[model samples]
Target: MLQDHLLEEHAGPAAETEPALVLANAQVVTAADSFRGAVTLQAGKIAEVTDGGAIPSGAIDCQGELLLPGLVDLHTDHCERHAVPRPGVQWDPLEAAIAHDAQVAAAGITTVFDSLVVGLRDADQTRRDLLGQIMAAVEKGETLGLFRSQHFLHLRCEVTDPTLLDQVEPHMDHPLLRLVSIMEHTVGQRQFPDAEKYREILIKLFHVPPEQVDERFRRDAEASRTFAPTYRAAICRMAHARGIPVAAHDDETLEHVEEAAHLGMALSEFPTTLVAAEAARECGMATIMGAPNVVKGGSQTGNVSAVALVKAGLLDILASDYVPVSMLSATLRLTGDDIGLTLPQAVKMASLAPAKAAGLDDRGEIAVGKRADLLRVRLVEGHPVVRTVYAAGDRVA
Candidate 1:
């Protein structure tokens, strides 16, 4: 059974009150259309959306900027970068939380699932223990209302690590633990179909000597072969019991998608090939692609490009992955491309679709009775700039 102590510790206290804020004279993007409008907020929830014109009492003028539903990031390692700024350097968890929160808010993400890897083959014991502390700080920040965005935990389970299941079960009941993605980073497959490129990237990431890369890869490959099935079963059971959404990452084949579907996983994140993505779609899973992949014009791992997937009607969500700013920028870029998507459709990939996939139904669209998470952006010379950000009707940036 999942531990309940972690949940109790993280639940801190109840919120006292909800503040109201209104935004007017902006072009609001709804599920249906984008038009000049005003959105009214009451107790941190959108009360109404009206035609653009005279300002209502207590409404702040948006000055015709484009108002969008705040971006929902389903996968981001930005916080992990803060926790480990360098190979061996570590920052205070609270300090890292503050820095990452501010950056994410400034980038117009009002909701983020901070992705942390659960299993590491060569990481020191101290580094593994830091995950608990980092998660605790995130919960504390949310409880104190000190964060700019709603922070949730998404454990990236390394299914090739035998110890992963043990570490993961203890945190399954964490209040902020909302999502999990089963990932196997074994070389020569899935995301890294090219062994040579995989070797190059792994060497840089692990700061390993070039000469030792091949030996380390061989060892890791053998370990993955041994642990894959055991880790997969454990993760599926734990996630299902806790009622958390599970995702399969870097899927490369039809069988991969079929297996995830059998586990009742609702998301297929970064399917490496078009065949995998299409198979995921057939299995009724939402396909997520990296926004950076779309912006950079190709996949960093040499997989099918996000734009190509989008054009083929297989991609449903766009995650910032490593770069938070790329989320909005890529959406805008997609609007101008020949992907048969309008501004609203493109925006949905970055905002609405992710929220839906994460089971957050309250704040993805500009609709009444939803959390007033919003972003005010302006397009200047074909570049998008975020002018303001709000989470739960409170201005955060």
Candidate 2:
């Protein structure tokens, strides 16, 4: 298991009596620049950052590894995938949460916003039943400090479902409900403009029965036509009332971007085309692309490429979406020759940018007074590897 593998590494240097933990001899990547430096942590926050090759006494030697701010993922469907590992297999909620946390922390993520799907009436009943159970378990795990990473909620609401408003109303005010995204996967629109591709996704990717694809597609299309407007409006209003930021998912058209902007969405999740991404920029909305898209060089659903968005200057944040390890991999890939972004610039898209988008200002950079959430990473055979992880100045993974 991944948890056992990560647990086998050494935690760090022995305990110090000076009330501060220093990581020296690191290639630190800050929000503004990268340098060979040392960082000090005290009282669960970053106390100081020093530029040089100096190694303070009693400091943990980083051995020239990369020191990056812990990643903040605004959208990740990882927990849901863990909760339902296969078509008919459902793991226990608390156990799934623990497994997901371990994977996320091992991937260099310290703050994770677990995306939970809601208001899918035609989907698997097992998945629908696990939503509340997963949320409750995550909340309990966070409260008891039973996990390595700090978990929050990102509710992905399907506006085509007429009961969407009711399904999300109770969670709107939940303290951990940090983000809400409105999306409708109607055939021949937005993400699934091609009916053939949509059919393939339903049967191959989502594991929907081939015999039931047409019926489900028709039902979803009809529901989208009838209920999308009202349900989308209601969900947005409810989220706005409590000051939670809303995101628009898989926007493909100029009008869709405009409507989402009018609804006061903070970000656009996975804009499916260049025009939509540009429109989002015009509307003062940040664009979030999936990390897997960057790693794989294209979207799994055959939409826009994340590298294209970077070249066009339209990408703002990077979400792991379904693959947690892709976060750090995508960050490093962006600094490659094809994309041509500096290490610091690439790291910000996964860390500071997402943190700011989610209204979290305290723990995204290697600066004084910020939460000491950091990652010790190294390159193994040219692939970035997470060596150790710390959250709020404590070594967690």
**Predicted structure with the largest TM-score when compared to the true one:** 2
What is the C-alpha lDDT profile of model 1 across 139-255, one tens digit per residue? Answer: 888777678788889999998777888888898888888899999988878988788898888788777789988888888788788998778877988989978999999999999
Cand. 1 Cα-lDDT: 0.87
lDDT tens digits, residues 1-397, model 2? Answer: 3222222211222344538989999999999999999999987788899998789899999999999999999999999888889877889999999999999999999999999999977666566767889989988787667889888899999988777777777777666788999999899989999999899988887778899988988889899889998888888888898788999999999999999999889899999999999999999999999999999989888999999999999999999998999999999999988789999999999999999998888778999978789999999987998899998888988
Query: How many Å off is the CA of 196 in candidate 1?
Result: 0.7
lDDT for each candidate structure: 0.87, 0.89
TM-score of each predicted structure versus truth: 0.93, 0.94
The superposed Cα distance between candidate 1 and the true structure at residue 281, in angstroms, equals: 0.5
Give candidate 1 misplaced runs (Cα > 4 Å). 1-20, 56-58
Worst 10 contiguous positions by lDDT, candidate 2? 2-11
Q: Which candidate is the best by lDDT?
A: 2
